[model samples]
Target: MMSAVVVAARAWIGTPYLHQASCKGAGADCLGLLRGVWREVVGAEPEAVPAYSPDWSEPARREDLAAAAGRWLSAESAMAPGVVLLFRMREAAVAKHMGILSVAGDAPKFVHAYSGHGVVESPLSLPWERRVVGLFRFPGH
Candidate 1:
């Protein structure tokens, strides 16, 4: 089951980044990548996602992304392949970015869609890991 999630996420590699969109091969943002994976692995999303800006409500300091993950996904304690990874772009900022852990341990890597990068797997480098504010798993992962 966990491998299924990783496989599904990897299937989206190279998808262009398109805000608020969630298609497998066309385009998707960080959250969209996760949403697409959710549909493939978990049947359907637990709730509808409203249109959000690139700021992700940071002006209000609302942890909208983290809150939603808490509500729908199973929270996890440590990094592991197939876990949902939520990141806070900056200290004291809203946890806005999302990714799926594709590889864990000494050299971890995660799959995500960024503004310019599209869907790709990146090494979970220190710079990226330091920004992680939340870790979660699709229910029953």
Candidate 2:
């Protein structure tokens, strides 16, 4: 199952970054990447996602992403492959970025769709590590 998750996530690589989009090899945002993977590996999505702005819920100071993850995903402490990583872009801001773990060893990597970069695998460097506020696993995984 974990391998399937990783495979699904990797398949999204090269997808163009597009806000509020979630089609593989087409366009997707960070959350959209995860949504695409979820559809591929976990059947249908549990619920519909409302439209969101680029700033997300930051202006409202709401942890909307984290709250949804808690409701639909299983929280985990281990930083293993295929885990869902929720990041706090800033100390005082809501966690708006997310990715699926692709590598968990020394040179850890994750797949996410960034503003300038499409869905790409990035090394889990110190800067990225410092922003991780929560880790989770797909439900039933």
Clashes of 1: 0
Pick by lDDT: which candidate is best? 2
Judging by TM-score against the true structure, name the best candidate: 2
Cα lDDT tens digits for candidate 1, 1-141:
457889999999999999988998898999999999999888878888998998988989888898899999988998888988999888877889999999999999999999998999999999999999889999777
Off by over 4 Å in 1: none
**Worst 10-residue stretch by lDDT in candidate 2?**
1-10
lDDT of each: 0.91, 0.93
Per-model TM against the reference: 0.96, 0.97
